[model samples]
Target: MILFQLSHAAEPIQVDDGYTVSKRFEKYRKLDTTISLPKLSFTEGQLVEFDLRYAQVGQRELHLDLFHAVPNKPSKGLIIFIHGGGWRAGNKSHFYPLANLLAQQGYNVALPEYRLSIAALYPAAVDDIEQATQWLLNHSSELGISTSPLIIGGGSSGGHLATLIGFKNNKQAHLLTDKPIPLYNAVINLDGLLDVTSELALKFENRKGNDSALAKWLGGRYETIPDLWHQVSPVNYINEDAPELLIISSGQARFTAGKDKTKRLFNENGRTITIIEHENIIHTFWLFEPYLTNLAADIAEFLMDVSKIEQE
Candidate 1:
């Protein structure tokens, strides 16, 4: 409850770890209990199983939770979801609602936790994500999957990482490549910041602590780490070979600058870009159940359409 209050503050603040993974609600766990991914009112029989584990077994190892709606049956597809907490905070469990909704659509969903700013910084999170993706691809068969059209998406900072994975497969790329973290079929950006440089470059920005979040998350000032910033920006690597993208963002003042960066990516690769503008919604509205119904429906339709094309 305290963390929730901190999250809704008008401006961002450095929050204490009042609720970490081990301290969060036990009901969020999959052991000794069952989770029913209840069907959306418009959809039916879409409940999934909760499976959790560390992608690697050690400290700072990635924690991955796979949502499987079907038992003993192979999944038609998979969606890897990353959650955003300004890069410093956030967790995978908070994403169960979104993951469960996706699982109901007959697609297995993987929600993985990367190292955060509170413990580590920039590429550390990226590196962890790479490992998580590789684990998914390497175990695809065991997970009942058989395709290359893996879709990646996330909210805010997580969206930034998801887009980074989609745009470039570089030195750190091996993290997702026990055997090549197959090229994504589509990429979803949920109100994410595509370019940190642009956000910092904004004129008279009211979000006073914008760069603080980056420095805290990336571990250095932009001027001192230009290359690192560029290497991490998904918008900087946009090209013809990028995956199909569906970007959802709010029209609120807080996210306008980041939206501009997303706009540039859309313009560069106009063919595969799908932008959904949410009126009056703030950043990360998808976290709550109120907007999840529509958000899930849209995501389901997009994934289904993409899957159909892959089959063809």
Candidate 2:
């Protein structure tokens, strides 16, 4: 491991040597575990909290948790980071640690909570994400950040949702508001759910259990509702105009199911895409290890580079 000095050091990452990979949670291993790689550049930083309502549905008022780092300099861009919960369980609060890390790197972070499967179904989560993005776009000024090139990011199922809302064709799914479609400058997907067709869904089922998450989130098994699976998949929505996308993954579960397919789709569509793989880790490793320090730095660098490229 490369040693970084105090001036260049990041907050110590959360490490777990005893993170046993059980048969039940083994599929979770397939997502991006953020294994150690080339040392990343670091920056010291602080977070400023902004708790504000970004949207409303029915009687439920939706609020976004925006965390901005005390900029040592000017801001790079705005990133809306979503939390992963299998679409059944997870809160926007889950990303608080990561939000601060990104903020330190000079990107304002927006962590938004979308409707979960327990409360709403399929496109509902997608609709909520659309509203969240729209809210960010509409309130960029009030939030005190740059509006151009809003970046969308997420982990696990949240990664899936980020991709769905960022790149998928607007006419295919429901939208939260009738305003113009939210266009993203870039997208960062960390082991997101990419495919829900019967083949991949059944594979996940056979690996984990018969109670596959894809079925629960979509309201039916892929075998029963093939069209819905196809419609909600981010891979199905790629085009030349799709945002420059960065997909992070591990060699396990989600990556095993979606990597090749994802690479092929993005390549065929002529989209600017970057794919990085980490070894021997479960999904979302930065959430846990000596990994988070550099992961944050790495992501900060990515955000900076992608934003500059898109701007040029």
Highest-scoring model, lDDT? 2
Clashing residue pairs for model 2: 14-288, 14-289, 30-252, 30-253
For model 2, how does the per-residue alpha-carbon lDDT over 1-312 read when each residue is reduced to its tens digit?
Answer: 122232322433121222222321354434534333223234555546555777767656567887774668677778888877677776676676677777766678888877777667788888887787777777778767775657888987888888878777332334435557766778888888676553654676546443567777788776677798788778777776677778777556644355577678778977678777787466655465465665677677676677333431
Considering every candidate listed, which one attains the maximal TM-score? 2
User: lDDT per residue, candidate 1, 1-312, as tens digits?
Assistant: 133233323433343464343333343333313322333342444444344444542432345888765554446677889987778778787677778776766677888877777756667787788777778777778765554557888987788888888777532344454555456778888877677677543332224443566776766767677687777778776665667778877654444345566567567665367778877554556655456767888887776666323511
Q: lDDT of all predictions, in order shown? A: 0.66, 0.68
Looking at model 2, residue 208 earns an lDDT score of 44
Error of 1 at 65 (Å): 0.9
Q: Which window of ten consecutive residues has the lowest lDDT sum in model 2?
A: 12-21
As a whole number from 0 to 100, the lDDT of residue 78 in candidate 2 is 81
